[model samples]
Target: MSDRDPQPVERQLPTEEARDLLALVRDIAQREIAPKAAEEEDAGRFPREIFTLLSEAGLLGLPYDSEYGGGDQPYEVYLQVLEELAAARLTVGLGVSVHTLASYALATYGTKQQQVEHLPAMLGGGLLGAYCLSEPSSGSDAASLRTKAVRDAEGSWVIDGTKAWITHGGIADFYTVMARTGEDGPRGITAFLVPGDAPGLSGAAPEKKMGMKGSPTAQVHFDGVRVPDDRRIGEEGQGFSIALAALDSGRLGIAACAIGLAQAALDEAVRYATQRRQFGRAIADFQGLRFMLADMATQIEAGRALYLAAARLRDAGRPFAKQAAMAKLHCTDAAMKVTTDAVQILGGYGYTADFPAERYMREAKVLQIVEGTNQIQRMVIARHLAGPEGR
Candidate 1:
């Protein structure tokens, strides 16, 4: 048999360039992210400067086209980079994922003219973006969102409504907004790219979240927010399809970030268990603790494989929606379990803020909820396997 890479987490990278890229990301994660992650997270500080730094490093636009100032890396490379950043800090990892999601409409569906006008600044030019989908009245039932966008005789559209649970809400430079533009259903909606400084757009105070406090989530209000006809993405009444397509890719991003968080927690647990002693021996030396550690590692590895499998399907341009849902469901659930076990391995110390384990545990909980809840993922998978429920 041919010799294979001996590493357990051995990646089947596509090229030397991808390997170099991974190294660059790891360097940034260690030197810039990890050193301040725990402290800044405790302070609830949003690292805007770090994001700018990442933009400067050309880290934000990987997986998009090089023709439009993006790095043109594939989904596999882009996601592995996300994993590295997440291993350093979940906030940064998830922030990058959200940014990519926010840009998807313009990148994938916007006209050539539209891409030329806005894609560069939004992708890698130090500007941030937010996606507007969830509203106060509709989340799981998102097609029922009531945010309205009405067009005047001059063809200018005016939007009015509140979008809820927006990540990077107050600080985003632009927003990809979906609003109802026609009848009373999914087909009535349309998407628009709205500038952050628009006269009638505003953000409410950030929510008091249980975790990822450094990443703000808030309500954004649009009161007659007007935009030129040129700002619409895709055709009117196609917004729901665009949003669903974006989420299909976005769910995989969350899965990768979840695995990153789980890996970090597992590393912390192993470190603590090996260093801390119990009954005149290291706790890690005991069979029970060893089994727990083994289980955690196995779960993380399995989750990583699941997300990568989904990512590969996406890169190959196959139908990966169902796989994306599976990865998101499996990975986030595994993250919740592994992180909890990690805290258990560290005992009291893990429960304290002094160690990052407790914080990791808290952060892992949100993964199960965002990008669609686990329950929602289950429904998506079931719908794919079986037909939709009969009315």
Candidate 2:
């Protein structure tokens, strides 16, 4: 709403094409996304049309293989693009991340025949996806999921159970689901690619969330939902491993998003303090407020560097699970602090919805709890440092 242009991000891209990709992302974000973000968020309206535009622009699957219609960009470049989108609007950025996560199983584990048959439609054909992992009783303990998929005599699978906190639950064109196929425990789980319109599958009403209402989060039910054997991804009893692998990369996506949210809050605070005067002088002239702004900006930069480092490790085919957890923990915590400080910076106006500070504050809270909680991230780091649990 300010007449000024969106703040520019200084980036170090390896190639000229990557720089151009970032530029196009910023242009679409400012012109198409940021302009409608505040209004649509307030109205709790999901912008399906904007997603269609992103698909056409080849922005939906940047990190996947271009042989299957993906952009074939590295995780390092793809994550920066996520940060730009998150800066403009959390819902759009996070939604894109979830879609990419949902596509992971098929893209990575599917056979050549399966990839050729499905990847094109999923990555570039304007189809949205949802990931179904967490169940009603399973939160941080995801491997203990109770959803069962039984193989029938005709080589068809029948799924029965509930999947909770699914993003894009009702609107997605496909769902990458994890279900129990054998005995209890992580090794017993299996992955499946289920069409959205599968028989006996339905979504409950979206949760009345405190923020990010524009991105629907709901419970999905499968009552004898049937699919052919060919729809399964990876081997039997391999779902839990696939889920964790996806989250390793997905955590970096979340870390980038958190940094982006913090950057937006910092930009707002800096803009407000420099323009608004107190006692015939700008509030930015005060030492206390100036130091506060400095600290906020520093946190954003540090978090950005942390996530990017993790992303680079992933790109290099190195072991980065611990680093990914560290990035997720540090970045989300920083976002919570920075956005809260931005609200404090504005004092009265920040509490009301008149400015974006309050919305950013609300949106940042969920980042701490999503992908994996900060507590879970800490556990992951400690396990890597010491040894596996009970070792």
Candidate 3:
């Protein structure tokens, strides 16, 4: 049997680059975000000010090229920044992740002119973005999306559909939308850049969610909204591929968020264990509880390793869909398990809104559901193993 590389939590090579960014992100999150995360979540307020702080800190474009106002940072560095933010506030981390997803099409597939027109604002100008690929009838099975786009005589197109579960919904400055432009199938879809103020485009009231309440989530409706053909991200019938490619990269972001959330939960549990007294001793001294802590820490390390591996594959221009699926699956599941266990360690305190554990537990559930569900991730990995002939 071939030997496989062993994974470790803290890097042995000592990546100064990743460390520096992580330190900065941690500072910002602690100073500006951590204090308010709980309040915003409780009040159902959007942290747009925090978003501006991130953009101004040159963090909004961490994984993109510097030519377009981006940081030109590596995925390794970018992901850790996301992790730090998630540890502070899941809402902000998830909002950043979703914005990165919405911006992928322009960065990866748009014409040079298109990128020049939009990339700067998206990267460093505090402009939020939303990705619109899912419809009421076509969430998991996106190829069956019914949104239609028809080209007009004036070289414009009229798009009509309702996109569901759009993060940043009414708050975003622009949307990267996928609509059917041909016959029914994945190949029939096309991608477009629609401004938030475009005619006939509107968002519904934000969805009542289980957690991550500070980040807005709602349905966006396009009723005869028009855009110039020049706004298209790629050739007609290429939206499905673009959307899938975005997800391949976007999954890494979700994985990072999940790992961060898990790390926070683990930290809280460990701190609580050490402080809370038992029978004349700290609960952490108990062997059974210590083993639980060990398991939580181990799972967190595994989640981080999985996402970093996927990120390396992505940066190297390798086929990363399988790895991305694996990262998302493992990390989100780990987040759920770790957060739930944290609540158990916290005992009755974890169940109350006064603490963050219960909130983090609820937030972790959505991570498993989004970026393609954990079930979808399994299907993606299985397809890789089966190969084309297996189809």
Tens-digit lDDT track of model 2 for 1-391? 3344436779979999999999999999989999999899999999999899999999999999999989999999999999999999999999999999999999999999999999998999999999999988999999999999999999999999999999999889999999999989999999999999998999999999889979999999999999898999999999999999999999999999999999999999988888788999988899999999999999999999999999999999999999999999999999999999999999898999999999999999999998889999999999999987887
All predictions: root-mean-square deviation over Cα? 3.8, 1.1, 5.1
Query: Candidate 2 regions off by >4 Å?
Result: 1-7
Please give the lDDT score at residue 220 for candidate 2: 96
- Candidate 2 C-alpha error for residue 28, in Å: 0.5
User: Please, what is the TM-score per model?
Assistant: 0.97, 0.98, 0.95
Task: Give the Å shift of residue 225 in candidate 1.
Answer: 0.5
Candidate 1 — number of clashing residue pairs? 0
Q: Order the numbered candidates by lDDT, best leading.
A: 2, 1, 3
Q: Give a tens-digit lDDT track for model 3, residues 1-391.
A: 0132222136422377667777778789989999988998999999899889999988888888789988888787788788888989999998899988999999989999999999999999889899999888888998999989999999899999899999998778999999999988999999999999998999999999999888889999999999999899999999999999999989999999999999988888877888888899988899999999999999999889888888888778788899999999999999999999999998999999878899999999999999799999999998898865445
Clashes of 2: 0
Candidate 3 — worst ten consecutive residues by lDDT sum?
Answer: 1-10
Clashes of each: 0, 0, 0
**Candidate 1 lDDT, tens digit per residue, 273-294?**
7788879988889999999988
Index of the highest-lDDT prediction? 2
Query: Candidate 1 at residue 34, lDDT?
Result: 92
**Which residue pairs clash within candidate 3?**
none
